[model samples]
Structures are given as structure tokens and as C-alpha cells.
Target: MRVLHIITGLKAGGAEQQLRQLLRHLPPEAECDVVTLTSPGLVADGLRADGVRVRHLGMSGNRDLRALPRLVRLIRAGGYDLVHTHLYRACLYGRIAARLAGVRAVVASEHSLNDAEMEGRRRTAGVRALYLLGERLGRVTVAVSPTVAEDLRAWGVPRSRIRVIPVGFDPALFRFDEVRRKTARNFYGLPEDAYVVGGVGRLIPGKRFEVLVRTLPHLPAGARLLLAGDGPEKEALWRTARELGVADRVVMTGERPYVPDPGDDAPGMPDLMSAMDVLAAPSAMETYGMAVVEALAAGLPVLYTAAPAVSDLPADAVPTAWHVPCSAEQYGRELLRLYAAHPGERTVPDVVQRNSIQNIARQTMDLYAAVLSDAPLEVRPR
Candidate 1:
């Protein structure tokens, strides 16, 4: 089957990384191509290296109407069997373009319905109307977590049209390695005996990285904090670290490049997780906690705040993940306990099996087949 994926951009974000991983595990019979509304960033090269054709629309900004017609033309010319869209802007434009191109099958995935937006400025009729319009254009809307699906339903997307498909990761790649852990720590110049607490994601307000920084002062003397990822809030986070008097203990590795080279011996997400003593996810909201899952896969105990993706699982699936309050004090207390009683190897076989990229790709392919065969504009819950 021929499929085309449309995304806002090919940056090194969770959704972008998930897309790349999914494509890598797609069945051999599936021919996939990607089109980014904006310029392709780090993920483009890796996708191309994996033999996936990626195109940039060269959109100047959000107001670029020319991209619509160009996208429609491309879809029509490619004769793709399905159009899969990711992110907000991509969903809005890709669905419309696919319909204009006479494509019968179109699907979109909702990676986040951030709590701040849902309860803040975005809780208005206009946003809901636009979302409903875009959802109506697609055959189905995939929710990365059940929590996101509930939010979509609240925003007027019919429950029947929503499918809960958690994002996947490769366990083999993220699994723990003692050698890589030592090497990553050495490369980062972390002291051998330092107790590292790590967080990974965009340095945004919603992530509440400030809370993690504040927790540093409460931690033991050798406890260090590492935040891997970058965003507009980086400067603010640095300022917070300075004000909290833990600037020296905080390490901000600005957006790590996405290099999927297996044998390259370079530090990646796996190595970074291995270097940490425990992973802390203090985000106010998350549709699916990709980093939490990855940390668990790498054999690190996790202290997270409301990770539906992890919490929704059967308790046995993520035994090492502890749901804690989104407070620096609570997190500090947990860290002390974890430091005292080191969390041993707790590999979640169930989580690894359920969230494998190959499994997710096959499930997604099944959804495509079902959508094509049924050809229902509106579906009823199964």
C-alpha cells in the first residue's frame, strides 16, 4: 500500500521521533513518503537515510495559503492509498488537501491536548469549531492516550472516530547498558559518584522544569540534575536555576541531535537514560510519556506526574514507574527514598512488548485497512 504522511515539521520532538520510528518498522509491502509543512529539521536526514522520501513544502509561516494547493497537487499526483497526518496544523491542512485530491482514506493523530490550553485560552467555541471541522474531514482521529481521546470527545470529536494507540519505542535500542552508562557520564563530565536526576523534553512552562530545578537544593550534595531538550523557555529555566542557587548542579544539553546509528557509539536517548540514577517527569500534562517509557525500558526508576500512558497500563507493565505529586518537595522526598534503596533491574517486558515500533506499525496498518474497507464517514463504537 502507498501512504503519505503529513506533519507540521520534522523536528526532534516526541511526535516527530515517533513518526520516524514507526516508518522504520513499517511492513515491507508499505511504501511511505513524508511531507513536512515547514522545513525538515533533524529528523529529515534520518528518514531519508532509512529510504523514506521526505519533501519540504517551504511554507513561510502559518498564513501560507500556497501550501494548500501545492499539497493537494502532490497528493493527487502521488496516488497515495492513504493520507496520515500528525500535529495540529498538519491535521487541519492535510485533511482538507487529501479531500480535495479525492483521497478516500485520511487519518490524523492527536499527540497532545495540553492541560493548560484545554483549561486556558483555548477553551473557546472557535477552537472547538476548528477542531471539529478538521476532524470531520478525516476518516479517523487517533489519540495517543485515552486521556487525549477523552479530551477529543469533549471537544466534539465522536468517540467512535477516536482510536487509542500509544506511541511506540524500540526496547532493544533503549535497553540498559553498563558500558554506555559509564561512557555517557564520562562524556558529560559527571562525577562518578554523583546521583543524577534526569528529565527529557522541551524546556517549556508546561513541562515544569522549574520544579525540577527547585528540587535540586533539597537533594543531597552530590545529586545533579540533567535536562535534555531545548525550547524557548530555556533562558527562563537557566534564570530559575540561578535564582534557586543550583545553577552549578543543573546541566542543560540543548536539543540533542537525532542520530539513529546503531553502532556509532555516540550518546543517544538510551545512553542518556543509562547515565541517570532516576528519571523525573514533572510535566503538568502529557498525552503519552515517551521519555517515561524509554527510561523504564533503560531500567531506570521514574518519578512522574500524571503520565496517563504509563498509569493506564496494568500495574505490572511499568513496575518501576511511580506516580508522584507535581511538587519539588514530593519529588525530593522520592529521590531521597530512591537514593537510599536503589531500584534494581526492573525490565517491563509487557510494556516493551506492547509498545514496540513493529507492533504499533502493524496495528496502524490494520487501522488503514479497516478504514479503507469500511469507507464510513462516521463510525460507531465497536
Candidate 2:
């Protein structure tokens, strides 16, 4: 089974990282390659190191009329059995290109779609029209969470065409270790007893990380807010911390240089998770709460505004995770309350088990087989 994955870029964002991880877990019998429309960066390097062929199409931006034909030619030349598109830009262009290249079995994954916005941009009418148009060109559309699947259905997508496949994490990489925790804390210059509140994922305005920064001054002096990931909002977050007179209490670690490649010396997301006492996701909107899931796998307590990844399950399913409003005062109060309770690493939740990469890869392979043989696309539940 030869497949080609096309994405907007190879930057270290949710969709890009998920694509890399998915490729890693795919069956060896299924060969895969990647195509990035533009700005291939850290994830691109990681994919190449994994021995996957990656091609970059320098077609500029959304209005790049030249990219369509270029992508079409590449699809025709590769003669892939199926083409899977990730992210918004690649979905639109890739679906059209695959059709033009005579490839009928195409699939697209909607990684960052929420009700009001997508990938931090507000969902406009024009965007919806274009998305639907592109969506029709593909045989199936994968939604990372049930919430996103509902969003797609509300937008007029047929229920038969949408698939809910939550993203997965390797439990081995995230299991808690006292020695690793101490080492990671020392690596980040965190004190042995400090109450660390971590915010992971791309530093974007839509993430409401500023809410965490604002909550810092309300917490005890020993409390620290460590934000991982990098983006245009980094400088602004620092300014907010400084303005609140808690600059010393806030640590902004820019983009980690490497991904979660086994045996890599550089500290990855799991190390950052280990260095934290609590994981806080301030975003009110989320397609799937990957950070929350990863923190749970690492056995850290999570305070999140929205995590559709765990929404379908019972509260007992994720006892360590609590829903908190996306406000500085609420977050501050919750953190202080939880701190007084003296929480530690909890067992990995059932949600992680349900979304394991092994199971997801098997389901995906089933989808590919069905699509190839003209079978009805079944919408499997989590």
C-alpha cells in the first residue's frame, strides 16, 4: 500500500507532529512519503531522519495558482495508491490535485477545526465554502475528536464521510519516573519543591496562554508557569508576565530543537511534562486536547478549559483532570486549591488506552483497505 501525505507545512504544530507520529506507527507493508506545500522546518527534518522521502512545493501562499498543477504532476508521477491530506491548506490543494492526477481514493484529516475558529483563525463563510468544496473531493474526512466531527456535520458534511480518530501518544515515552523528573526539573532550572504549572503546544493567542500568565501573580510565590512550544505570541506573553511583576516566576522555553525521537539527547515534550507539577490548558476551544492526554499519560494532574478527547468518557475515567474556567482568577484559585491538596502523579487514564497509536494505526489501515475496495466508509466510535 503506497501512500502520499500532503500537508501545509512541516512546522512543529499539532497537525505536523501528528502526521510524523502516524507515519511512524503505520504498518511496514504500507510505504509512505510526505509533501509539504511550504516552510518545511523541524518536523520536515525529523521525517527525513526517519528515512521518509519529503518534497517541498515552494508555491508561496493560499493564492499560489502555480501549486495546483505542481502538486498534480507530483501525484501523477508518484502513482500512490492513496493520498491523505492534513491541515486546511493541504486539504484544499491536495484533494484537487489527487483528483486531477486520476487518484480517486483520497482522504483528509481536519486537525484544528472548532465551531468559531480553525487553527486560530476565525471561521468565515468563505473559508467554510472552500473547505466543503475541497472536502467533497475526498472519500473520507478524519476528525481528531468527536467535537470536530460534530462541527463538520453541522457544516453540512454527510455523517457517512466523517471519521473520528483521536490522536495517540506512546505510553512508554510519557510514563513518570522520579529520577527523570528530578533531572528534567534541574535541566530547566526549576526548584525541587516549586509548584510548576505547565502549558504545552504552539504558543498562539488562541491558546489563551496569557490567562495562565495573568494567573501567576495570584498564586503563591513558589508557583511557576512554564510554557513550552514557540510561536509569534512568545514575546507578547513575556511582556504580559513582566507587566504583572511576575517575570521571574514565568519561564518561556522556546521551541524544543528536536522531536520525540527515541534516544535523542535533547529534552522533548515528555521531559518538559516530567518537569511540571500540573498541566494547564487555557484554550476554551480545542479539536482534541493532546497536551492534556500526554500529561495524563505522564501521570500529572491536568486543569483544562476544554478537552474533547476526554469529553465522551465519564468523569471517573479521568479523575485527575478537572475542568476550570479560562480565567486568571479561576485558574489561580484552582491551582491554589489543588496545591493545598498535595497531588502527585496519578495512573494513566483510560482515555489514553482507547486512543493508543497501535489501535489507531490498525483502524486507519482498515479505512485504507475499505476505501481502496469501494466499501462503505464506516464511522467507528472511540
Q: For model 1, how does the per-residue alpha-carbon lDDT over 1-382 read when each residue is reduced to its tens digit?
A: 8899999988778899999999988888879999999958768877988889999999888779999999999999999999999988788889999999999699898886766564223556776777789889988998888778888887788888988787987888877788888998888888888999999998878889888898898888899998989888999988988998988988887665445454545577778888898999998778788888888788788999968778877887777889999998999899999989965665655666678887899889888888878754343322
lDDT of 2 by residue, 1-382 (tens): 8999999998777778778878889999889999999989889989998999999999697899899999999999998999999989899999999999999999899988887886556799999899999999999999888888888999888898999887865767788877877887887788989999999978887889999999888888999989988898999999998899998988877665335556656577778888889999989888888888888888888999988987767778998889999999998888989899886546787667877777888878988998999898777433
Give candidate 1's error at residue 218 in angstroms: 1.5
Error of 2 at 368 (Å): 0.6
Screening candidate 2 with a backbone cut-off below 3 angstroms (N, C-alpha, C), the clashing residue pairs are: none
The backbone clash count of each candidate, in order, is 0, 0
Give the best candidate by TM-score: 2
**Alpha-carbon error at 220 in model 1, in Å?**
1.5
